[model samples]
Target: MLRTIAMGVLVGSAILLTLIVFRKKLGWAWLSLFGTHLILAALGIYIVNFSGLLTEIYIPLNPATIGAVTVLGLPGVIMLLGLKITLF
Candidate 1:
Protein backbone atom coordinates (compact mmCIF):
# COMPACT_ATOMS: atom_id res chain seq x y z
CA MET A 1 0.00 0.00 0.00
CA LEU A 2 2.54 2.50 1.07
CA ARG A 3 5.01 1.36 -1.55
CA THR A 4 2.37 1.61 -4.25
CA ILE A 5 1.48 5.10 -3.14
CA ALA A 6 5.11 6.12 -3.17
CA MET A 7 5.61 4.70 -6.63
CA GLY A 8 2.54 6.53 -7.86
CA VAL A 9 3.84 9.76 -6.40
CA LEU A 10 7.22 9.21 -8.02
CA VAL A 11 5.73 8.54 -11.43
CA GLY A 12 3.43 11.54 -11.11
CA SER A 13 6.35 13.75 -10.22
CA ALA A 14 8.34 12.52 -13.22
CA ILE A 15 5.45 13.22 -15.56
CA LEU A 16 4.97 16.65 -14.07
CA LEU A 17 8.64 17.40 -14.45
CA THR A 18 8.68 16.23 -18.07
CA LEU A 19 5.69 18.39 -18.87
CA ILE A 20 7.30 21.40 -17.29
CA VAL A 21 10.63 20.80 -18.96
CA PHE A 22 9.34 20.05 -22.43
CA ARG A 23 6.35 22.41 -22.35
CA LYS A 24 4.83 22.70 -25.84
CA LYS A 25 8.05 22.61 -27.83
CA LEU A 26 9.01 18.94 -27.68
CA GLY A 27 6.02 17.35 -25.95
CA TRP A 28 4.54 15.92 -29.13
CA ALA A 29 7.92 14.65 -30.24
CA TRP A 30 8.41 12.89 -26.94
CA LEU A 31 4.99 11.27 -27.16
CA SER A 32 5.66 10.09 -30.71
CA LEU A 33 9.01 8.64 -29.68
CA PHE A 34 7.35 6.78 -26.84
CA GLY A 35 4.72 5.39 -29.21
CA THR A 36 7.35 4.28 -31.69
CA HIS A 37 9.34 2.61 -28.97
CA LEU A 38 6.27 0.76 -27.70
CA ILE A 39 5.37 -0.49 -31.17
CA LEU A 40 8.92 -1.60 -31.91
CA ALA A 41 9.25 -3.40 -28.60
CA ALA A 42 5.96 -5.24 -29.06
CA LEU A 43 6.86 -6.22 -32.60
CA GLY A 44 10.26 -7.47 -31.55
CA ILE A 45 8.74 -9.60 -28.82
CA TYR A 46 6.12 -10.99 -31.17
CA ILE A 47 8.68 -11.89 -33.80
CA VAL A 48 10.87 -13.67 -31.28
CA ASN A 49 7.90 -15.61 -29.96
CA PHE A 50 6.74 -16.56 -33.44
CA SER A 51 10.16 -17.73 -34.58
CA GLY A 52 10.45 -20.16 -31.68
CA LEU A 53 14.24 -19.85 -31.76
CA LEU A 54 14.52 -19.34 -28.03
CA THR A 55 12.00 -21.95 -26.97
CA GLU A 56 13.60 -22.50 -23.61
CA ILE A 57 13.49 -18.85 -22.58
CA TYR A 58 10.51 -16.60 -22.18
CA ILE A 59 10.38 -12.89 -21.63
CA PRO A 60 7.32 -11.83 -19.70
CA LEU A 61 5.27 -9.01 -21.12
CA ASN A 62 5.36 -6.32 -18.48
CA PRO A 63 5.85 -2.60 -18.03
CA ALA A 64 9.43 -2.91 -16.82
CA THR A 65 10.55 -4.89 -19.83
CA ILE A 66 8.56 -2.63 -22.15
CA GLY A 67 10.09 0.44 -20.59
CA ALA A 68 13.57 -1.01 -20.86
CA VAL A 69 13.06 -1.83 -24.51
CA THR A 70 11.52 1.54 -25.11
CA VAL A 71 14.55 3.27 -23.71
CA LEU A 72 17.18 0.97 -25.15
CA GLY A 73 15.63 -0.19 -28.42
CA LEU A 74 17.17 -3.31 -30.06
CA PRO A 75 20.01 -3.32 -27.61
CA GLY A 76 17.45 -3.61 -24.87
CA VAL A 77 16.06 -6.78 -26.37
CA ILE A 78 19.55 -8.24 -26.63
CA MET A 79 20.20 -7.35 -23.01
CA LEU A 80 16.98 -9.04 -21.95
CA LEU A 81 17.94 -12.14 -23.90
CA GLY A 82 21.32 -12.17 -22.28
CA LEU A 83 19.82 -11.81 -18.86
CA LYS A 84 17.36 -14.59 -19.53
CA ILE A 85 20.11 -16.87 -20.76
CA THR A 86 22.43 -16.21 -17.84
CA LEU A 87 20.00 -15.75 -15.00
CA PHE A 88 17.47 -18.45 -15.74
Candidate 2:
Protein backbone atom coordinates (compact mmCIF):
# COMPACT_ATOMS: atom_id res chain seq x y z
CA MET A 1 0.00 0.00 0.00
CA LEU A 2 2.80 2.41 0.79
CA ARG A 3 4.68 1.52 -2.38
CA THR A 4 1.52 1.96 -4.38
CA ILE A 5 1.00 5.39 -2.90
CA ALA A 6 4.54 6.39 -3.65
CA MET A 7 4.25 5.19 -7.22
CA GLY A 8 1.03 7.15 -7.63
CA VAL A 9 2.68 10.27 -6.31
CA LEU A 10 5.60 9.86 -8.64
CA VAL A 11 3.38 9.44 -11.64
CA GLY A 12 1.31 12.46 -10.68
CA SER A 13 4.36 14.62 -10.20
CA ALA A 14 5.82 13.54 -13.50
CA ILE A 15 2.65 14.42 -15.30
CA LEU A 16 2.39 17.79 -13.56
CA LEU A 17 5.98 18.67 -14.31
CA THR A 18 5.71 17.57 -17.90
CA LEU A 19 2.56 19.64 -18.33
CA ILE A 20 4.21 22.68 -16.79
CA VAL A 21 7.18 22.33 -19.06
CA PHE A 22 4.94 22.17 -22.09
CA ARG A 23 2.48 24.81 -21.00
CA LYS A 24 4.81 27.59 -19.89
CA LYS A 25 7.62 27.20 -22.37
CA LEU A 26 8.03 26.86 -26.08
CA GLY A 27 10.77 26.13 -28.64
CA TRP A 28 14.30 26.66 -27.39
CA ALA A 29 13.21 27.47 -23.86
CA TRP A 30 11.76 24.04 -23.32
CA LEU A 31 14.83 22.56 -24.94
CA SER A 32 16.98 24.33 -22.41
CA LEU A 33 14.71 23.13 -19.65
CA PHE A 34 15.05 19.62 -20.94
CA GLY A 35 18.82 19.94 -21.03
CA THR A 36 18.78 21.27 -17.50
CA HIS A 37 16.55 18.40 -16.45
CA LEU A 38 18.91 15.91 -18.05
CA ILE A 39 21.85 17.40 -16.20
CA LEU A 40 19.99 17.28 -12.89
CA ALA A 41 18.94 13.71 -13.54
CA ALA A 42 22.51 12.75 -14.35
CA LEU A 43 23.59 14.32 -11.10
CA GLY A 44 20.92 12.38 -9.25
CA ILE A 45 22.15 9.18 -10.84
CA TYR A 46 25.71 9.96 -9.80
CA ILE A 47 24.55 10.62 -6.27
CA VAL A 48 22.75 7.30 -6.26
CA ASN A 49 25.83 5.60 -7.63
CA PHE A 50 27.92 7.20 -4.93
CA SER A 51 25.51 6.08 -2.25
CA GLY A 52 25.49 2.66 -3.81
CA LEU A 53 28.90 2.01 -2.31
CA LEU A 54 27.18 1.55 1.00
CA THR A 55 23.72 0.44 -0.16
CA GLU A 56 24.84 -1.75 -3.07
CA ILE A 57 22.34 -0.04 -5.35
CA TYR A 58 23.74 1.61 -8.45
CA ILE A 59 22.02 2.79 -11.57
CA PRO A 60 24.03 2.79 -14.77
CA LEU A 61 24.26 5.96 -16.83
CA ASN A 62 22.86 4.76 -20.09
CA PRO A 63 20.39 6.12 -22.63
CA ALA A 64 17.42 4.32 -21.14
CA THR A 65 18.41 5.38 -17.67
CA ILE A 66 19.08 8.91 -18.85
CA GLY A 67 15.79 9.08 -20.67
CA ALA A 68 13.84 7.87 -17.66
CA VAL A 69 15.55 10.23 -15.27
CA THR A 70 15.31 13.04 -17.77
CA VAL A 71 11.63 12.56 -18.37
CA LEU A 72 10.46 11.66 -14.89
CA GLY A 73 12.90 13.57 -12.69
CA LEU A 74 13.80 12.29 -9.22
CA PRO A 75 10.90 9.90 -9.02
CA GLY A 76 11.99 8.15 -12.17
CA VAL A 77 15.52 7.65 -10.88
CA ILE A 78 14.02 6.44 -7.64
CA MET A 79 11.78 4.03 -9.46
CA LEU A 80 14.87 2.70 -11.19
CA LEU A 81 16.51 2.19 -7.84
CA GLY A 82 13.45 0.45 -6.50
CA LEU A 83 13.32 -1.73 -9.56
CA LYS A 84 16.93 -2.69 -9.12
CA ILE A 85 16.48 -3.53 -5.47
CA THR A 86 13.36 -5.54 -6.13
CA LEU A 87 14.63 -7.41 -9.16
CA PHE A 88 18.39 -7.59 -8.80
lDDT of 1 by residue, 1-88 (tens): 9999999999999999888867756547777888988999988776766778988878887889888888899999889999999998
Off by over 4 Å in 2: 1-26, 52-54
lDDT score of residue 24 within candidate 1:
56
TM-score of 2: 0.65
Encode model 2's per-residue lDDT on 51-72: one tens digit a residue: 6564777789999999999989
**Residue 25's C-alpha lDDT in candidate 1?**
63
TM-score of each: 0.71, 0.65
CA displacement after TM-score superposition, residue 33 of candidate 1 (Å): 1.6
The lDDT for every candidate, in the order shown, is 0.85, 0.88
